[model samples]
Target: MFRRTFWFTSGVAAGVWATTKVNRKLKQLTPESLAAAAANKAVEAGHRLKDRAVGFALDVRANMAQREAELEDALGLHADPELPPARRHAAIENRNKPKSYVIDRTTHTHNRNEDH
Candidate 1:
C-alpha cells in the first residue's frame, strides 16, 4: 500500500512538471515572443554585417596602399608625405587641364570630300 501511494504521488508530480514545461514552451511560441526573437536575430545579423563591412574596408585600404607602394617602387618614384598647399593646388590644376591636339584641317577636308 505504501509503494502504491508513493508511485501515484511520483506520477502526479511528473505530470505537473511536464505540463508546466509545455505551457512555458507554448507561451514562448506565442506571436509576440516569436516576433521579439526574430527582431533580436535581425539585430544580431545587422551587427555582424556591419563588422564584416568594416573589416572588408580595412582590408581593401591595406591592399590599395600595398599596390600603390609597389607601383611607386617599380616606377622609381618616391612618395612625398607632405607638400605645400600651393604646390598641391597647382598640381591638381595641371592634372585637370584639357589636352590640346592639332589636327590637319586640309587632310580632314579631303577625307570628308572623298567619303561623300
Candidate 2:
C-alpha cells in the first residue's frame, strides 16, 4: 500500500513538470514571440554589417592617403607650406629710402613729391 501511494505522488509530480515545460515552449512558439526574436537577430546582423562597412571605408581612406603621399614623393612636389613666398619686387636700396614731405603755408597742405 505504501508503494502504491508513493508511485501515485511521483506520477502527479512528473505530469505537472511536463505540463509546465510544454506551456513555456508553446509561449515561445507564438507568432509575436517569433517575430520579436527574428527582429532582434536582424538588428544584430545590421549592426555587424555597418561596422564592417565603416572599417572598410576607413581602410580605403588610409590607403588613398598613403598613395597620394607616395605619388607626391615620386614627383618631387613636396614643399613646406608654412613659410611665405619671397617676392623681390623692390630694389634693396629703395626699400630703406624715406620719402620727404613738404608743408606749404599757402595751401595748408603737405606735398609728398616736393623738394624740402
Colliding residue pairs in candidate 1: none
Candidate 2: deviation at residue 34, Å? Answer: 1.1
How well does model 1 score by local distance difference test?
0.86
RMSD of 2: 21.1
Candidate 2, residue 17: Cα displacement in angstroms equals 2.2
**Candidate 1: deviation at residue 104, Å?**
47
Clash count, one per candidate: 0, 0
Pairs with steric clashes in candidate 2? none
Q: Which stretch of 10 consecutive residues in model 2 shows the poorest summed lDDT?
A: 94-103
- Cα lDDT tens digits, model 1, 16-112, are 9999999999999999999999999999999999999999999999999899889989998885669543332333445554555556677756554
Q: What TM-score does each of the candidates earn?
A: 0.66, 0.60
Cα lDDT tens digits, model 2, 21-44, are 999999999999999999999999
Q: lDDT per model, in order? A: 0.86, 0.89
